[model samples]
Target: MGSPKRGHHHDLYQIEASLKEILSLLSEVEIDHKVLFLNADAGFDSENLRQMLEKEKIISNIKTNLRNNKTAKNYYYFDEELYKRRFNIEKANAWLDSFKALFIR
Candidate 1:
């Protein structure tokens, strides 16, 4: 019920917070990979986000929409295996939403 007010958010503001959260989680773990691949859904996809990823030298695996890409050449290179996991997570959230008893509010 606590959604952001309509015009207060843009893609970068939303994504920057998500990125920081991911980084905080990663800080508590030990991983082998030097090059990290960040997979974000279409909503988080923007030119600013792309530039941020490129400048950090992180692999950008973002889903695209009509507004983001005019041609195939401009699209982000997505990893099929990892990208598939994104949808799985979304599906899990959808399934969880069916339980009315869990939401106290």
Candidate 2:
């Protein structure tokens, strides 16, 4: 429910670490579940992270830039209709940001 922290505008490694941490927490909680839907900005795209998720047999539905080289020959199974519906979550964030009090100076 929280976004990964970005310090000095360099957050690639931090985002990866946060994802790993979240996975570990989920495992510790003993939540037996399949199909993890992860939505992330393009910066979170990394081969190592993707391979880790694959090794763990966790399906990830992440948003990424089509032009990124990391997508080369990598087959991701996702429902386009479902993804379109999920776009509302992003829109909600934009709507919330309209209230300047939500921002911390």
TM-score of each: 0.55, 0.58
RMSD of 1: 4.6
Residue range with the least summed lDDT across 10 consecutive positions in model 1: 1-10
Clashing pairs for predicted structure model 2, backbone only = none
Show where candidate 1 strays beyond 4 Å: 1-11, 29-34, 55-57, 71-75, 80-85, 96-105
Q: Model 2 Cα displacement at 77 (Å)?
A: 2.8
Best by lDDT: 1
Off by over 4 Å in 2: 1-6, 91-105
After TM-score superposition, what is the CA distance of residue 25 in candidate 2 from its true location, in Å?
2.2
- Writing each residue's lDDT as its tens digit, candidate 1 over 1-105 gives 212445766556666556656565666675422378777777777877788667656788888866756775565577778988988888897898877658865
lDDT of each: 0.69, 0.64
